[model samples]
Target: MPEIVGESLAKRLIAWGVDTVFGLPGDGINGLMEGFRRHADQLNFVLVHHEEAAAFMAVGYAKATGKLGVCAATSGPGAIHLLNGLYDAKLDHVPVLAITGMQETSLLGSRYQQEVHLDRLYEDVAEYNLMITNPQQMPGVVDLAIRNALIKRTVSHLTFPNDIQIAAVDEDPYAHPAPGTKPVSLPNLDRPQLAPGEPELRAAAEVLNAAAKPVILVGAGALHARDEVIAVAEKLGAPVVKTLPGKAVVPDDHPVTTGGLGLLGTKPSEEAMEECDTLLMVGTSFPYGKYLPDPGTARVVQIDADPTLIGLRLPVEAPITADAKKGLQGLLPLLRGGDSGFLDKYHKEMESWRADMKALQDESRDPIAPQYVVGVLDELAADDAIMTCDSGTIATWSARHWTIRDRRQYFLSGNLATMAPGLPYAIGMQHAFPGRQVIAYVGDGGFAMLMADFLTAVRHDLPVKVIINNNNSYGQILWEQIVLGYPEYAVRHRQPEADFSTWARGCGAYGVKVTKPGEVRGAISDALAHPGPALVDIDVNPNEPPMPGKVKYEQAKHFTEAFLKGQPHKAATLATVVRDKINELRS
Candidate 1:
């Protein structure tokens, strides 16, 4: 048999260490699917129900492993279905390679069936997008796409014309060697170390060392630099505040951590931002500028790999452009230890904040509070479990109360903030780390959107545990409307209330429902013990509010008025929330 381009592509992917791929099969990519089949022992293709899930699984896999993730789709609709997940990877700065099939070359400009301008469609989401029309370019193009994705920390796209996929490979595209050297045999695809110059590092250190009270804000990009970030925080006696996506960069229970620093953050973080004279931002471009201190009030020192993002969100007093690890390493030597009083003050506030949260978690209501459920689940979950969360109120709760520690990985649709990624991310995480525990905290709104994929887990025998916050409503939108001084409308998911656990059982997985606080731990424990996929539907209190870190009087007033005008029946719940806010302020 002659060597085919598709087979060469498969072999190249395996050579580059691609063990698994996620996608659906279609006529446009049948030739490529055959190649995958030929290399079954070397490559595993996970068949997902939808192309969107395939892309999300790719994003999830990249996030969990910090390596390149690959996904494939057919022409037109299949390629279009990948946009949302591709955006998630793009915005979050993960490495992902997307392989899309195009109509045959002969059919180009002839309006072929399912024909799509895939190269143009993928332009915005991919840092490196290319179309391969020649069969000889197969293995080389594949290698280049993977290298670009890994090196750029961004998405790369390849559009292969259907007919060319199976065409005969005549010569090696990579035969050309360097000047006066032999033909290159093996490719070296690796990222180079990026660091700041000595002067820039010294300038950043001077700004930090001169400040009387400094605060550290870390983001997802700083995950690999956790130890360095912690050391800098300790040296400066600064309290660490995480952007939502960076929640796990430092253990929440760490002494220097004041928790997250936005709407979903803790009071200590909010207070620290208000009082700090200097801010050291590491590897984050958190979009909410209003949540951060006024640029005039706090001098900013930013450290990031991307120069364009160094001072994008706020004005920077000192900018150090380097990878997080190297950037912090450069600053550590010039840093001077400050008075311990600042961190000590915030530590006391953090303790008080935790106590207040505990009171809410222990509050006995007819319907169990979601906080209580998450609190107990936090205690019962495996120390090293990977937790993927959906957007909206579920993200808020998990960010604020998840108690991430012990090298547990946390993932969500960070910059895109898209819905329905929790389950797909969980699926991918479980696929990457088969022996590690994987859990997804999903809201009913998100869960309903992609619940069909639960069967994927069952079919693959992936033992992922899903915890659904069954509030029967778009909880986040409801609160958003109220806080914006508008009555809640069209946010409820009423009637035909779903029993997610029962639905899971029907899909050949373990199922359980927890309506009482007492059962939260048991339900979670049972799900973990089950040797297969499981769903625990937690019917939490619908009236519980995801309060902001720093609540304004105007917001409280608006929330009260909205509740009275539209949901008069829940006036009692509104009053309770108001009273709690007042008490929090008093403390």
Candidate 2:
């Protein structure tokens, strides 16, 4: 029987456990589209409004499930559009496979209409990038790309020419053997784990055991090592501070969770970092060196799989090169508990910080404080909800207030920190787990950027809920200008405010707008209860600023001067902040 190369490629991918692919159709790749049609029974293709969204959906899928996510695009412009999302996967260390089409082999050097130098374009972003030139190389190359992505935890790219995709091939890569033939052998795909040696673990333990006040900083790499991380923390009586990407590793409600530490983090975590004598960093290369204690002020002991990342962000005294889970297991046996007095002090501070957050949530305001909206969302969300957040000021609210309990999955654009990923991430999550609840917490600026895809969800019948914090501005950028002593310009959305509920309904989905503080909970409940895709546009206060963990005197002076220069209308917001600070002090 005759076989097409694209068909063999698709079958090999299915064998490697890829069930779904996100992409758009274009004229450059009629061959790959034909393969999709022929293999429709085995594989599902999710159509997206834009190729960029398709790539982000793949990233979201990879992040949600620790497996290889697949995305496809046509030649030239279509492939270029996928760079932003692919970089998101690259920086965050998620496994993703990108398949793109190319111009026909016959048009090699003729400068065809839609040709692109895809190999060079994807060079930096992909760990494995290649163009399939031979029909016989079909199944083998596909297998190699998948393996490389999974093992390296990076992006892999494979470009197939339009002519070669449908070219005839003879042998099936998975053909049955003859009577006397030997059994076929395949590469083992099991994950590799490395544990630190005795001396290395002992060295790390000795460093931690001597310190008076030690703290644990966790990152995305330590996600699966939650138990081990907590064990080490408990053994040392140290506080566990999660990085932005590590928030879900340990729930905020955990007794030792100090939330996150940085610009978008909690005060308790900043305090822990400032006061600790030793910083035991677990599977994280947190980028903000300034937020951490000075080199001599705190000794650093870092554990990571990659040796190069050991002291990338800070000085290290003990470097243990191993997987987070295995490294922690090796060190746990040699560690001794530090002073309980240090743990007691941080615990009380954490409690006070949480109480202050709750008080802010309870305080009602005219435009509906976003903090209250997030607090209510924490209460109403399902136990296993998958929450996807857009990058911006809304990220601050999500980090500060969203309580991740019941092992709920929280995903964002982590290192790349791109906008317009929230909706696509939620869509991908819903497609991956049809029964589970998915929520996209988006801000006004970000939601408008990709609202075109709201129709994609509706068309696919995905019951994803979207909560829009409609502050009508790029709130984070405005705050940055304020804190940097620069006047705000070109940051606010000059257009009139959009009623997102009306827009959602126009796109054939359920939509509601909540303007009052009292109506926030009911609106969210109703949106969740809707049978199809729903959007809840809440008019959160635009004047509310995102408070960082540490505020310097210069930043305060800049903020005050900026407010006096052009933001005098925000005096009421300043008053509200002062009142909240006084209340926090009294508490």
Candidate 3:
């Protein structure tokens, strides 16, 4: 058979080191599926339950391995389904390439079935978008899509019409050129090394050296520069405040580490930010400006590879547009050691904060505190475990209770703050690193959104442990309404309480439901020990709110107003809040 465009595309992806493709097959891409079959030995196609899950899996894969993640779909709706996940990748700045199918060339503008203009649809989400109309455009388009996705750290897209997918290529796209003609070389996939200039480094160091109390804020951008960030923090005696995505950048047990910032943060972190005279932001434009120091209160130095993100969230006195690792390396040598007093203060505060948190993880709680469940997992999980979290109150528990140490890595929908990616992300991480343990820390509401994909894990025999905080309510939304002085409405699950464990068992996976606090640890331990996919549904107290680090008077007033305004479970919520505060005092 002649070399078709689909075959050439598959071959090119193999050449670029893409071993797996996460997507569902459809008639629109029947030719492409055939090509994938021909190269099945070299490339693995992960058949996902939904196109959205496929896109999220690609995002998860890219986030885990720092490589180009690829996902494909059919035309129209399949292509439309990829938008949310693609947007997640775009906002998080992860590299993902999306391939879709188009209607046949003859059907162009004929209003045929599944005839969607994918190029215009993807224009906003993709860094590079193209629709291949000719067989000759195959090699260059594929190369450019992968190249742009990697270099720009965003989504790239390509759509091929059904007729064009199987069309024969007339010439060798990768062959050596004739005399006086240029050769077609594959695009380099490696990212270019970028470091701050000497002047920029010196300027940043000067600001650091001049400050009496400096706080280093790290984000996802600093994930690969852990050592460099540590060196800088130690040299400057700065308290390390992590953004949620940067939770693993520094171990929670580190002397200067103060846990995460913003709503899902520790008191020490908030205090450090409130008091710091100089702020050094690494690879994060943490969006909550209220959580940061006042605009002119502190001098700021930010290091990021994306120039567009520098000084975005705060005013910066020194902006270094370079890779986090390289920028920190250059800035470290010029830094002068500051007094250890500031770090010492926060270290003591962190100890108190941790003690208070430990008090809340009481095993005596009847409904089983979510904190207790996560704390147990933290104690039992492997040193190199990978954690994928869903958005909502579960994120609160994971951020506060899970201590990331050693080789443990955490992934979440940081910029998008979307739900349902937890399970899909876990599946992707398990695929990327088969030997390492992967767990999805998701809430009941979030897990319900994508629970069908649990079957994917079972089918593949990927042992992904899922720990669900089964509160039977939209816990985060409930808390948000209360905090805003509004009575919670339609937040609680109206239907019969979902027993996720039974569903897991039906899907041919290990399953357990833990209602009592005493059962939490054992259930989690067993799930982790299972050889295949397992799910643990632990019923937790829905009334327990994820309180902010420092609850302001306004928030307190709102809580009172919400209760007075006839919020459901008002008595239970007030009791829970009061008990938690008393526990904090006792600690």
Candidate 4:
């Protein structure tokens, strides 16, 4: 039995459906790069200025195509640089293979240059981490990483020690071939239901039967039984209100669907959730618990895929452990249809909320409405286009305002909330889904954080159109300073004139700049028309506010600082926002 080493790893990479790899080839890992060069016919290598962007690009690709993404880096600093994006992948559950080179196997513990314990460092952030110590373990390790990335739906890692790459080995590709894809369904477990379950279920139905205001809170879990979820909502004459992760669970324009609810959510969703006494949270978990009004005072029922979640965060008067689809189906027959009063009350509130939301477009005066820009993008994007949004206020914008429906896809780093990640991910997505349009919306601040990678798109001719929201500052942080009673520190940046279009032309691609609201549609048209990579840079209004949230200003400022200052997993900031998301649709 023979085995492969460095070049063989590259071959196995292609066998596992990896079409591209992003990373820099440094002194410690030139052998893998050489292997990649020989197999250039089957694989493409994207070069970026930093390893962080490479990891982010991989994340975007997975989000868009529903396939495993691959990113690599040299030893030491290069591998360390990937931690930021690695954490991002872990939190979002994006499948990624983060490969890195290591020092000579003999030198690993000798404090040699570029030598570090790669496996231990990556353990917490990766679903599985491995150090390829032998050529015999080559293909098996490679296959395992890919399977973990896809099956666990998480970040997986592999490290190649310098000595092993140059060591003598065999060349059997079948030592381990790629595995099959995993099922999308979450696991069903056996757990006990609360005592008041059946009674509470009927009581919740009574509220649904009796109330004039009823809104259904749809979470990401709805993806499993979309048809059943829609059927249940329509049968009860309830409007669907979603959480951030559940943006696309229900159609945005569905007469029975309200948009996302959060800091960047719309008044319609807020009014429906906050004012409605009878709230049904089904198939998802809303982390912002504090935002949810006390269930004890209101009629609250929870239907979760996992039984543990039934009463995990807040005590659900009604907790159903069955699949949301199964539970909803079971409960519907027992529900007696109610009068028009509750539905009419919710409808009235939704109408007023819709009017207030509509007024945002009326800010058609200069600087351009960021809200409308997002709206127009939603309208112009192809039916199947995959959109990736950066973290921060722009993330809120997409979650709250983007016209995502049951069929559309909108990817966000909702759990990790990293900036400057959307562009790189867009490039990877374009490679994975060559036929589908891939669009990325990034704030000026976030874009600059990884600006150089725009060239990576040009080099590969990955025709991704980027919408740069040029607000000239850290817009969200600035608002926090004002509201939180802190002087604006590090929030403002010099209004730099970044001629992305000119740069695109220089880079052998396309670029368009729009300064007003009217120009957005035409620019988007021009971008979609262009043959290759292009960017639509729009000067957005910094004052365009988010939908709504309960985070205090001062706390928000410190939270942003913790992220920008390199403190990953700082609980104090994220803890506040992680409250059980109360999808108490006012409707």
Candidate 5:
């Protein structure tokens, strides 16, 4: 029997070094499932509870390993379910390939069962989108889709009609090739070695060397250039501030580092940005313009692989278009040793900032503080662990409290800032590094969105530890409402809160619930030691506010107005805020 399109596509994926595919099975893609079955030894299909989870798993895998991530879904609604995760990949600039199934070719334009136009639906999200109606499209289409995803660092999609999926190829497309013609082959995965020209490097160095106070801002693009970043920071006497996704680029305890910058940033970081005369942005296009130095007040030098992002966020005096690693390497030698006066100032501020943060993690609080929970996890988690975080107040705690040390890697929905990727990301990270420790730090609302995937962990024997900040509310939105001068309306969770620990046990995994501050550490320890998948549901104080780095006058006034206008739990919120302020003063 000749090779079928589905089999050919499967073989092509394996040839391109895809060891696993995440998806849900359905009748719409029966032929593709058969192909996956035949290649079971080489390619493992991770069955997800939802197509959205499968797409998120692919994104998590791609972000963790820097390899092309692949996911599949059936036609119509299954394909529609992939939009959220695909948009996450697109916004974060990760490589992902989405494979979808379509109705039979005979049903073309008939609006048959599950006959949704996937090509049109995926247009905005995909860098390359195609529908395979012919068996001969085979290896060529698959190869192109993978290449587009990897090369562009974005999403690629392909939809296969049911009838065409099983059609046999009559002839070898590679056989009897014309002279000087090369047959379709696996794409080259190595990134092109790109560096800024000597003139550009020298110009950027001049801006840095001339400034009396220089600050270095790093992002996810700078992950691979840790040493180079440190060298430049040291030479310029600059404090290194990271974007959320760039948290792991420099260890939290590094001498030149000053944590993250933004709403979820540190006081020292915000100060450095405010006082700096020159801002050096590397590998990141940090979207929040408010957190950056005022335009024209500070000279900007930016280095990134994408030329379009060079001056996209802030005004640039010198823009170097090159990979973060190469750009930093070239500029390092050109930089001259400068005064340590600027860095010394922030070092002292960082010391006080650290003390204030430590004070906020008081384990004596009756209702467990979310800060305390994260601090304990930071202390107990393995040095080389992989952490995946969900959006909400959990992001603020993770950003400020969880210190990235040693070989630890952190991944989150940075640009998209979407919820529900936490558990799926951990699952993907566990699959990528089978023996390494993987943890998902999520909020009650975010976890509850896709809690069904906890079974995916047990079924696959993936040892992923999940820590839930069980506040029983949409805590972030609640605070946002107060800041916007509106009373909290629909942010609270209904009565009879979910018992996630019980849910974990039902899924055949280790489960622990901690209600008091004292039980926090032991529960976390037990969950981490459980050997298999585990979940820790810690009932934290819902009224505790995730304070910003520096509170603005307008925010304070609006918060007060909201409280007067009938914010729920206003007394509890005020007490917690007062207690934290007192601790800060004492520290």
Candidate 6:
């Protein structure tokens, strides 16, 4: 039995279900990479081009799979580059175990080639940052990193010094993880409560029972509370309209689910939110209050685990601080209704909206319709396919188009909207669910930011499919310019288009380039069917704009004011625009 340091640490990470660690290797972290390579049989090391993408992929993997994700980098610049992605994970509550190799311990105070105080550098992004001083502490620190990451639901870090790379402890203490390292309990926590204050529960139950038109507003916290949401909705005969973060808590196409509400929302979801009289904000703090109409005299009953979040945004009529699952359990038994018309009406509206949206997709034959590509993708994916989406218009399309029918999982930046998250995210998701199908939807500009990571995915043999919507420009900026009435400038990629397909092929990844609308789906399907990593670069239609909830009457006004100084005012309300849309759906 050999004593160990980074090598043993890598070995132990594998036992904890960390199959792949995404990051670039450099001088400072060469020892860690070397250690990882030595244990290649036990752990798979992903050599990415950028530490940033490495971090993001870990974030994605953790999100899609519910396992603590691992990513590594060298000290100095490598460590610095991880900040953006790490923060994204930190803010979104993903569990990531970040490891970095630093300069020799002897160079602690010196400006040696990549010597920096990494512990301090990563302080803000990690829930727990461990600086390994000796091999003896390796096992504890590694285990601590994993446990803390899962418990706190945040990024955790371990920094290794070059001098301690091969130090021999009394023994290879971290040979294996203890049994029950990962629990199989309910993902949503259940605990003892203050009996939910009988009066409060009764009042909440009565509010739900008596209401005819009820809307369930779901969010990410709601995902953990899925059973609770469904139970309440079923008992009360209500429709569910989730926020983007809460999209898959209930099947998107569930008869009771109107769909997700946000900028890229469907007519049913928006109308349901606007028209419902009693709103149940369950386990979600939907940050966008503007989307919440002054509630049209609607009453709100919000259930949240975090007490601070209750009534933190908009005041609620009934705010319960108990766990959503428990609270809903108590409330559901008290209400019984068979008003099937609510779901029936939403189903009808959903069908009409789908038809109109499909018609819009069919109209986009100019170059490649990303919308239609997404729809075809929705068809190709298995019922349980996991999708990681990049921020931008791609998020818009995925939200509106990718039906969570039957089964599926979707990960988006939600509110962060980081530019280059999808490719790395696909890697993470694939890493987590090795046998499950994982795909990343990205835009040309976003993919360009971290396209080099395809090599890392290849090296790990992660069978993740990356679909790039190559429209030759930042589509979001173009939309911004359009809404603002400004001339398009500098938003397009100025660099010569790197042959991404060739780049992938060169890295041992299958690559498909689809320029025409007709070829997009076939290329994507083939790449997905491949046994290993692949990239599909499809030239998408640029004129297919990203519309955000009909554009805020104020933001649109500001865009016009800033860009078109003397333009006529766009009408505040357009009755003709959504008139028949509402009728066709809800009439």
Write candidate 3's Cα lDDT for 138-201 as tens digits: 6767877888898889999999999988888655434644222122244434454586899999
What is the descending lDDT order? Answer: 3, 5, 1, 2, 6, 4
List the global CA lDDT of all models. Answer: 0.86, 0.86, 0.91, 0.71, 0.90, 0.75
Clash pairs of candidate 1? none
Q: What pairs collide in candidate 6?
A: 57-424, 61-428
Q: Is candidate 5 or candidate 6 better by TM-score?
A: 5
**Per-residue alpha-carbon lDDT of candidate 1 for residues 257-370, written as tens digits (9 for 90 to 100):** 999987888889988999999999999988988778887899999988888898898899899888889999989989988998999999989998887776666536557778
**Judged by TM-score relative to the true structure, which candidate is superior, 1 or 4?**
1
What is the RMSD of candidate 1?
2.9
Per-residue lDDT of model 2, residues 284-372, tens digit only: 89888988888788899999987878999888989998889999999998998777778778888889888888777754677788888
The segments of candidate 3 whose C-alpha lies over 4 angstroms from its true place after superposition are: 171-190
Q: Which parts of model 4 have CA positions greater than 4 angstroms off?
A: 1-3, 11-16, 34-41, 168-215, 275-283, 298-312, 316-344, 405-407, 495-497, 547-587
Residue 349 lDDT, candidate 5, scale 0-100:
87
lDDT of 2: 0.86
How many clashing pairs does model 5 include?
A: 0
TM-scores for candidates 1 onward, in order:
0.95, 0.94, 0.97, 0.80, 0.97, 0.84
User: Model 1 misses residue 536 by how many Å?
Assistant: 0.5
Model 4 C-alpha lDDT per residue in residues 378-468, reported as the tens digit of each score: 7778877778888777886676557765357777776777788888878877878778888888888788888788888898788988898
Better of 2 and 5 by TM-score: 5
Q: Provide the clashing-pair count of each candidate structure.
A: 0, 0, 0, 27, 0, 2
Q: After aligning candidate 6 to the native by TM-score, how far in Å is the CA of 255 from where it should be?
A: 2.1
| Candidate 1 lDDT trough over 10 residues, lowest sum | 177-186
RMSD of each: 2.9, 3.4, 2.5, 8.0, 2.2, 5.4
- Weakest 10 consecutive residues of candidate 5 by summed lDDT: 177-186
